[model samples]
Target: MISPTLIQAKGLRKGYGQRTVVDGLNLDIREGEVLAIIGPNGAGKSTTLDLLLGLRRPDAGTITYWTTDPSPHVGLQLQSTPFFAGFTAIENLRMFAAFYGKRLKDAQLMEHLHRCGLEEFAKTDALRLSGGQQKRLAIAMTLVHSPKLLFLDEPTAALDPRARRDIRELIRSLADKGTSIVFTSHDMEEVHKLASRLVLIRDGRIIASGSPEELLSQYGTASLEQLYIQLTDEPA
Candidate 1:
């Protein structure tokens, strides 16, 4: 069965000076599903995410969450996650958990690290870790509070193939456990592998949206890459 809607946005519009970024967008983030928002650069994908996350106010729109206080149940992992200078990987997880007002035992903390494949780097300074390790650590930090809804921006960008595969598996596991994930990515293969549904946007408007198979069939395209190219190509 489909899960309940965890967040709803209607007619979201945001702009800077004379330029609009997110224009007349509507979205629904339901529980226990993975939703990917994809688009070319400058297509307002990130702006749409910010509007839905409430990090930026829209010029016109309304956003509603399942609960009145959604922060306790939400997690956000931006592309760049800054860790405290001296905190180790495990320490960062503890600190983030405390931000949500929860204290985790060592076993619990280790479990989070283990899941993200960071247990070996538990005591390593977060900043000292390699780029991919830091990325995984950031994801671990988001899970410390066991949030019901997670927003990941470019979760697997720039990682080596193995790291990317690991992160994909992690996302799949999270969805299996019923966490609603909203992520943005340029990797169509990752999108095809992970997204139960997706929204494709351009110039701040949705151009196409549906499950991978659904959109592919609707457009009569062989794959998502082909569909993306077809829909996003400039008109002659």
Candidate 2:
């Protein structure tokens, strides 16, 4: 069964010094759904994410969350790793949980580490881990509080094929376990593989949105890449 709407955004708008980044956008983030927001470099995808994550305030809009306070129920993983200097992997997870006002047992922390494949590196400095390991650790930190909603920005942007596949599988696992995920990605294949629904934006506005297969059939395109280009490319 489809879950209820976890987040509702209406008439979202944001601007910077006479230039608008997010222009009158609206979105619904449903429970247990994997929603992918995709667009070109300057399409304001990141800005929209920031607005929804409450990292940045929208110039005009209303975002309603299921809970009174959404922070405790939401998790976020940015593209860059934000590990504390000199902190081990497990320590960082503990720190993050503490930030959320929750103290987890050692076994619980270890379970998170094991889930992210970082148990072996529990004592290792997070910064000393490889790029992929750091990303995995970042994800583990996000899950420390066991949030109901997750926002991931380019989770697998710069990783090896194996690491990318690992992260993809992890996302699939999370969605299968009834975690609502909202993520942004430039990789069309990854978006196609993981996104239950796709929101294609241009210049801060949604040009198209629907299930990947639905969009493909609507546009009569072979793949998400072709549809993306057709809708986002500049007119000659």
Candidate 3:
């Protein structure tokens, strides 16, 4: 039996006036897997996430979250970690969790804090948290609603080795729990470690896609980084 698609983007097209970002792209992310979109800078990774989240309409395509439930679920972590500066760590979570229209009491909030290793710092003001702490906070907040589909944009772009590993582990745990993930990352090491499948894009179109080992073998490369460079260098 075939499992249902969690998200499908058909002929996705987006642009800022004359400069088109994504051109005739189509992709699908299914339940219980991690699909990482990796490409060169300005390759339209963020734009694709925006369209997929329904934050913006595609100029000529359909982006749908395929669920019978009226309010099909999704959670997003945009390029930056957003939180109210004056609010404490737990406070920040409270605000966003409320926006999700879900009631997460203090006990549950503390549980997430403990899971994120932020229980000691729960009372600290969000603005005062370090960059790694902030990123962890973002991940914890995104998990507040226990969404079916998660969109993460460059989640570890600016973090030390330890923090990066922690976030990647968190993602792995979530995927194991059956939450579909669509993440974009410049860190090939993290991508190779976290993604069940890789979707490579160049100039807004998918140029190559497969498992990390498959793509590496196919492109005669030792790493996903090398495969990415080779693929994006070729003209489609």
Candidate 4:
């Protein structure tokens, strides 16, 4: 049996005064799947994400959520997660939980911090945490409400190898437990590892999309990096 569609977007278009960011894009996000949107800088990946998450309104398009209570069912983790610099990690989680209209006990909150590998940093101020720890804390904040669908932007960016692996594992674990994810990343290898479906966008348009293996096979390229360069690199 096929999974039900969670989000369906049609003709998604966003633009600034003179430049278009996302143009006539249509996509479907299904339940319990990882969809990775890959692109170079200025390719509208961020804009697409904002539109999907309702952080930004599209100039033209319609987004439909087939599931009830879609608003609370979604969560977002951006490249630079905003937090109170003076607040401890645990305190930040508590604040966000309350914002989401949920009250999490200490034990429950600690469980989430542990999952993100931030248990030891629970008492650490958000400003003092290392880059990876901050990222993990941001991820932990997103889970305060137990969202069914997650939107992550550059989730593993600027992390060391070990930290990157940890974040990747955390994402996999979430997917294993039936959380649908849509993420944008410049890391081709990371995308290949975590994404079941890939969408390539360029200059505000989707140019190619498929599974990693399918894309490699179709482009006759050995890796996603090569295929990405071939697709997006302009000839001099």
Instruction: Give TM-scores for every candidate, taking all chains together and pairing residue i with residue i.
Output: 0.96, 0.94, 0.94, 0.95
Local accuracy by lDDT, each model:
0.91, 0.91, 0.86, 0.91
Q: Model 4, poorest ten-residue lDDT window?
A: 66-75
Candidate 4, after superposition: displacement of residue 20 in Å? 0.4
lDDT of 1 by residue, 118-144 (tens): 899999999999999999999998998
Per-residue lDDT of model 4, residues 85-122, tens digit only: 79999999999999989999999999999988888889
Best by TM-score: 1
Q: Give the clash total for candidate 3.
A: 0
Candidate 2: C-alpha lDDT:
0.91
